[model samples]
Target: MSKLLVNEKEIVVPGETLATGMDNLPGNGTYRDGENIIASRLGLVQLEGRAIKLIPLAGRYIPKTGDTIICKVIDVSINGWRLDTNSPYSAMMSLKDATFDFIARGADLTQYYDLGDYAVGKIINVTSQKLVDVTMKGPGLRKLKGGRVVEVASNKVPRIIGKAGSMVSMIKDATGCNITVGQNGLVWIEGTPENEFLAIQTIRKIENESHLSGLTDKIKAYLEKAKKK
Candidate 1:
C-alpha cells in the first residue's frame, strides 16, 4: 500500500519522508529511496496527482540561458560591459550584442552605459563554469532611469508576477507605477515616490505569503485598502 506522509503546501526540510511505496512517484526536489519518497531540499511541498515536488523557499539566483533579467552596469570595457545579475556570477554584454548601431572603437563606452546604471537585459549564454553573457538589443530591453530597484527571493518571482501577469498588472493599475520583475529577483519600479512605496510594500507582501492559499484574493483586497489610504 502507498501513503502520502505530508499534506500539500506543507513546508518540509531535507530528508523528510514525503510518501511511502512505489505507487507514489518522486518529482523535482524529491527522490525515491527504497520504498520511501524523500524530500531532497528545503521547500514547500506540492502534490500534482501522484508526483510530489518542492518549491524552494530561499536561495541565491542561479543564472540560466535565455532568462530575461534586470542588471546593473558595474564595469565598462572597451568592447563590452559587465553587469551584476543579482547572482554569484556576473554577466557580459558585448558591444555587438549591446545595440544594433555601430559603436566606434575606444569612443568612451560610458556615453552609452555609464557605471551605476540599471538595464533590462536577456541572458544569451551560460557556460558550465557559470560564465554568463547578456544582450540588450531585444524588445523591452533598455536602460532603466530614475527608479529604485528592489530584491526578493528569486524562487517567489512567479507568485510576484502571478498567473498571466494578473498580479503585477493589478499593482501597476492601483499604484500607477511601471514595474519590471526580473527572473533573477531584481525589480525596477518607476513612478512617484508615494506610489513606488506602495508597490514595493505589495510585492513584499506577495513574497511573504506566496505559499498561502487564496493569495490572489488576499493581495487584491490589500491593494484596494491601500489605495483608499
Candidate 2:
C-alpha cells in the first residue's frame, strides 16, 4: 500500500524515507529509490497532491540573475567597485551602472560609495564561471545608511518575508523600523536603537521557527507580547 511517512511542514533530515510506494512522486529535494521516496536534503516537507517536495531549512545563497541583494562595498577601483554578495562569489558594479549621474573620468568613486558601505543592488548578469554583475540603477536601490544588517539562512527568507510580505511588514509596524530583506539572506533594519534591536530579535525568531506550522500567527502573537513588555 502507498503511504506517506512524513506530514506537510514536518522538518526532515537527509536520507529519510518520505513515502513507501510509487504512488507518491519525488520532487525537489527528494528522490526515488525503488518504490520509496527519500529526502535528498534537510528541509521541510511540502506536498502537492501525490508529489512531495522539500523547502530547504538552511543553505548559503547562490547568485542568480534578477535577484535583488544587499551587498557591502569591499573594493573601489578607478572604473568600478567590488561587492560582497553574502555568497561564495562576489559581484562587480561598473561606473556606468553605478549611478544615473554622469561621472567625470578619474573622479573619486569613494566619495559616492566608499569601502565598508552597504548598498542594495540588482544582479544583472551571472557568467557560467560565476562572475556576477550588479546594478544600482533602480528604485529602492541605493546605499544604506545607519542600519543594522542581520544574516539568516537564505532558505528562510520566504518565511521571514511571509506571504505577500506580511511577516516583515508586521515587524516594521510593530517596531516602527524600516526593513529591507535581501534575497541573499541579508536584512537591513533602520530605526531607533531600541526598535532596531526589537526588529532583529523578531527576525531571528522567524528564522529559528520557520519550519513550524502556524508560523504567521505565532509571529503576530510574539510581536504583540513584545510590545507589552
Candidate 3:
C-alpha cells in the first residue's frame, strides 16, 4: 500500500518521511530510505502524480547552462567583460556575444557596458574548470537601468516564478512594477520609488514564506494592506 505522510506544500525537515511504498517515487530534495521516501532538506513538498519533490527553502546560486540571469559588470578586458554572476565563479561575455554590431578593436567598450552596470544575460556554457560564458543577444535580454536589484535563495527561484509564472504575474499586477527574476535569484524592479519598494517587500515576503501553503493568497493580502498605508 502507498501512503503520504505529509500534505502537499507543507514544510518538511530533513529525514522526515514523505511517502511510502514503491508507488511513490522520490524526486529532487528527497531520497529513499528503506521503503519510505525521506526529505533531504528543509523544503516544501510538491506532488505530481505519483512522483514527489521538494522546493528548497534556501540555498546559494549554482551556475548552469541556458539559465537566464542578471549580472553586474565588474571589469572590462580587452576581449570581454567580467560579470558578477552571484556565484563563486564569475562569467565573461565576449564582444561578439554582446551584440550583432561588429565592435572594432580599441572601440570604447564602456559605451556598451561599464562598471556597475546591470544586464540580463543567458549562460551559454559552463566549463569543467567552472568558467562561465554568457550572452546578451536575445529577446528581452539587455542592460537594466534606473532600478534596484534584490536576491533570494537560488533554489527558491522556481517558487518565485510560480507554475507558468503565475506568482510573478501576480506581483506585477499588484505592485505595477516591471520585475525581472533571474534564475540565479537576483530580481530587478523598475517603477516609481514607492512601487519599487512595494515590489521588494513582496518578493522578500515570498522568499521567507515560500514553504507555506496558500502563499500566493498571503502575498496578495500583504500587498493589499500596503495599498492602505
Candidate 4:
C-alpha cells in the first residue's frame, strides 16, 4: 500500500511519493507518504493504519464553557457593548452583564470601555446561534490602552504565548516590549514602536514555524541575530 514519512511535526511539504500515497486524503495537517504518516501539530497524534493519515487529537479552537479571553471594545449601545472576538463571530457585553452596581442614566459609559479598549473578559454564555456573551467582572478583567494590537490565526496563539506564558515572557525580556496575548488571537504589544515591531515580527515567526520541534531555541537564536544586525 503506502509508507509513512517522519517529520518533527505534521507539515505539508511539496510532494507525496508512492511509499507515501493515500487513496483518499483528509484535509491539511493529515498527510501520507505511503502508509507512514506523521502529526503536523503539537498535540496527541492519531493514526489510521491504512491508506488514511494522521489526525491531530486537538483542534485550535472550539468555543467552550469557561474560556477567559482578551477582546477589543468596538461599539457600545444603550443595551450593551460590542466586542471583537477575533473570530468570524462577534461578542456582546450588556450593561447589565457587567458589575452589579447601579449605573447612572445617560452617564458616559464610554469612560468604562471606549472603542479600541482591550479587556480580559470571560465567556458567560454561547448560544446555539453562535452569539457569544462576555463579562469583565472577574479577576484580571479590565480595559486596555496605549498598545498596538495584532491579529493572527487562532491556531498560532498558543505558540505565541507558549506554555505558561514562557514564550511571551522570553520575547518581552529580549525586546523590552510588554505583551498581552488574547485567547482569540489578538495580541497587544506596548513599548517603543521599534521594540514593539521587532516583538511582533518575532512572535509571527514563532507562529509560522510552531509545528517544527525545538522552536524555543530557534526563536532565541533569531532574537540574538536580529539584535546583532
Best by TM-score: 1
Weakest lDDT window of 10 consecutive positions for candidate 4: 10-19
lDDT of 1 by residue, 112-173 (tens): 89999999999999999999999998889998989899999999999999999999999999
- Candidate 1 accuracy as TM-score: 0.89
Which structure is stronger by TM-score: 1 or 3?
1
65-167: candidate 4 lDDT, tens digit per residue = 4777778789988878998887667799999776567789897778778887788788889888888999878877667778788877676777888888888
lDDT score, candidate 1, position 218? 97
lDDT of candidates 1 onward, in order = 0.93, 0.93, 0.91, 0.72
- TM-score of model 3 relative to the true fold? 0.81
Cand. 2 Cα-lDDT: 0.93
**TM-score against native, each model:** 0.89, 0.85, 0.81, 0.71
lDDT of 2 at 86: 99
Clashing pairs in 3: none
Model 4: lDDT equals 0.72
Error of 4 at 170 (Å): 0.4
Between candidates 2 and 3, name the one with more favorable lDDT: 2
C-alpha RMSD (angstroms) for model 3 = 3.2
Q: What ranking emerges by lDDT with the best candidate at the front?
A: 2, 1, 3, 4
Q: Can you write out model 3's per-residue Cα lDDT over 1-229, one digit (the tens) per residue?
A: 8888989889999989999888999999999988999999988899988889998776678799999999999999999899999999999999899988889889999999999999999999999998999999899899999889998889878879998999999989988899999999899999889999989888888888876889988888898899888
Whole-model lDDT, model 1: 0.93
